[model samples]
Target chain A: MYLAKIYVTYKPSILDPKGETVKDALHRLDYQAVSDVVMGKYFEIKIANDNESDVRKMVEAFSQQLLINVNMEVFRYELIALSTAV
Target chain B: MYLAKIYVTYKPSILDPKGETVKDALHRLDYQAVSDVVMGKYFEIKIANDNESDVRKMVEAFSQQLLINVNMEVFRYELIALSTAV
Candidate 1:
């Protein structure tokens, strides 16, 4: 099997309310060094097939088709082997 | 200013309870297409300085030092210009 890690986030031009809330909380907690925060979604897609190339293709297609909203966000992903055990 | 979008996710070998919970939620919500959901932290670090190279360096350093745990997670980022209006 192959493991696909995907990340999706809002475009720079849009305001992120959730991130702002977290930023405020962090500041309140004395983490003043943090200036801003933007929140995003993460997903792991497990492909039953073990071929790295095939997994990459599937993840690329999935991200482009369903994982991200290009009008508001961008996404990227990585593929890794599911197991290295004997 | 520069916009730094960072994404962090758990390593594949690690068991992700959060992801499983989300998967269950989706299933309950009738979104059967979703097989899994892995949660992660996302941040947008705004740099006061607009130098792209400097911002990239700062983000890289920040991610390595405070943003992600190399043992349990991986992260990646992208840089975008904050403004283009004249």
Candidate 2:
């Protein structure tokens, strides 16, 4: 089995209202030092396949097709092989 | 300045409907090799503070109070210091 840890975030040019709201809240709470807040999505996926290449392809497809909106977001992933008991 | 990259995810025991829906969609698309899909949040925060310790404290406080729902989600962050113009 393989595990893919995926991180997805908005492109720099996009406006993130959620992040802005959080930033305003932080300022309201007196965290004046905070700024430029951008928010996105994360995913942890367990794959039944053992082949690294195959897992990568599957994860990439998932990210592009279902997990992220490619119109405004970008994604990156790291794959880890899982230990199996004999 | 400091940049904090934060990841927030549901506890393993928590039910993730979003992940489940994605999984179902993947299965429908014939990616049966995929399973255990968990979805979460990612944030990129730029802080004006130069002090590493102060930035860490502020990010931690933000994570606890604003970034994550303590009842179900847990957060982790990495802080990076920005280069200052001499």
Candidate 3:
């Protein structure tokens, strides 16, 4: 098995309301050093396959088709080989 | 300035309905190799401070008090020193 750690985030050009709200909240709480906050999504996927190439292709396809909206967000992932005990 | 990349995820013990839904969708889409999907939140925070310790303390507090729910979710973050241009 392999574990895929994926990060999906809005394109830098897009406005992130959640992030803006959080930033305002931080400022209200006196975290004056905080300048900006951008919010996104993360995923941990456990793949049942052992082939690295196959797993990568599958994960990439999944991200493009289901996990992210390519028009608004971008994604990246890292794969980790899992121990048999898992 | 520094960039804090934060990841907030549900504890393994908690049920993740969104992740489960994604997993089911993947299976339906014929990505049978996908065994599980765990969803989480990602944050990119830009801080105006240069002091590493102070930034770390602030980010930690932000995660605990605002970014994550202690009972259901846990968070981790990495601090990166940014270029003056950003």
Candidate 4:
């Protein structure tokens, strides 16, 4: 099996209110050194497949089509072995 | 400046309904190879500090107390130079 780790983040131009809120909270909590925070989604998917290339294609297609809103978000992923992932 | 990328995930024994929902959706979308999905939170925090160790310490404190529910979730982070992050 292959493990696909995907990160879906907001586009640079998009303002993430959740991130801004977290940053503000951090500032209030005395973490003044924290200047900014960008919150995103992380997905760890286990694919029951062997071919790395095929797994990559499948992850790529699903991440874009089913996971992210292309207009405001962007995604990136890396594939690794299931055994090594744990 | 330093960038701390934090990944907060549920403990192995915890139940993640959202992850299971996503897995079901992926199967419906023809990604039959997808056997499992674990959804988590990703944080990219930009710390305007020069000391890597201090930045790590601050991130560790804030991530635990403010960002995650320590009882059910665990977090890991890696710090890198801001210039190298983007």
Candidate 5:
């Protein structure tokens, strides 16, 4: 089995107003030291498949095709192997 | 400067319908290897403060009071120092 951790975030050029608002909110909450905030999405997935190369391909396809907006967002993922006793 | 990477996710007992829906969608897309999916939020924050303890405290407060729903979600963070060229 494999576990995939995926993170999807805005492209560098994209303006993250939600993040900006959160930064402002933090400042109001007395966290004045906070300078910037970028918000993103995280996904934890468990795949029953064991083929490393196939797992990578599947995650890559899912992130690119479904999880992110190709023009404004980008995604990255890490696949880790899990040991299971039969 | 410091970078705080925060992740917030639903408590294990909570029902994550969104994640379930995504998993079902993936299966429809022929990603039959996928067994489970959990989705959460990620925040990349930049803090101007240099004091590690102070930063940690601030993040702890912000996460508890604002970022997470005390009953349904839990959060974790990693603080990293960044070198600045003056």
Candidate 6:
């Protein structure tokens, strides 16, 4: 089995209202030291496969499919073995 | 200055269409090993302060305000110093 960790994020240039709101809140919360806040998503997926090449193919396909919005978001991932018994 | 890293994620019960789409894409891409994909957001905030207590207060307020939906999303954060010259 393998573990795939994916990090999803909004394009830097895009305006993230969620992030803006958090930054504003920080400022008001007396943390005027905080100037910015941006938010993104992270996912950890488990797969039952042993082939590294196959897993990469899987993650690449996953990214292209449902994992990301090419228009607004970008994604990156890392795959690790579940059994570090080695 | 400090760095606030906020990780935002969709509640498990919530349906992430983006994640679904990525999963579907992975299947079609011949990575059938991939069964699911869930996406979320990550925000990194840079604060201009050295007071740890003040920074925590700021992040807590930010999370309550614009950092998290409190309804649809959840967030967690950590603060690290920018200058480790010590």
Instruction: Judging by TM-score against the true structure, name the best candidate.
Output: 5
Model 6 lDDT tens row, A1-86:
78888777788888888778766766666667667666666786767788788888877766666667889988778888877356
**How many pairs collide in each candidate, listed in order?**
0, 0, 0, 0, 0, 16
All predictions: root-mean-square deviation over Cα?
6.7, 1.4, 1.7, 2.7, 1.1, 4.1
iRMSD, per candidate, in listed order: 4.9, 0.9, 0.8, 0.6, 0.7, 2.6
Candidate ordering by TM-score (highest first): 5, 3, 4, 2, 6, 1
Worst 10 residues of 4 chain B by lDDT: B77-86
* Poorest 10 consecutive residues by lDDT, candidate 1 chain A: A25-34
**Residue B5 error, candidate 5, Å:** 0.6
Candidate 6 per-residue lDDT, tens place, B13-78, comes to 788787687567666766666656666667788888788898888777766676667888777777
Clashing pairs in 1: none
* CA deviation > 4 Å runs, candidate 3: none
Residue-wise lDDT of candidate 1 within B1-86, one digit each (tens)?
A: 66777878888898778778766755665445445567777777765666778777767766776667889988888887878357
Residue A64 deviation, candidate 1, in Å?
Answer: 21
Candidate 3, residue A32: lDDT: 88
A1-38: candidate 4 lDDT, tens digit per residue: 99998999999999999999999999999888888899
Question: What docking tier does model 2 reach?
Answer: high
* Model 5: CA > 4 A from native: none
lDDT of each: 0.72, 0.89, 0.93, 0.92, 0.91, 0.74
DockQ scores of all models, one per candidate? 0.26, 0.89, 0.89, 0.90, 0.92, 0.53
Model 3 C-alpha lDDT per residue in residues A1-86, reported as the tens digit of each score: 99999999888898889999999999999998899999999999999999999999999998999999999999999999997673
Which candidate, 3 or 5, has the higher lDDT? 3
Pairwise TM-score winner, candidates 1 and 4 = 4
Better of 1 and 2 by DockQ: 2
What docking grade does candidate 6 earn? medium
- Candidate 3 or 1, higher lDDT: 3
lDDT of 3 at B60: 96
Return whichever of 5 and 6 wins on DockQ: 5
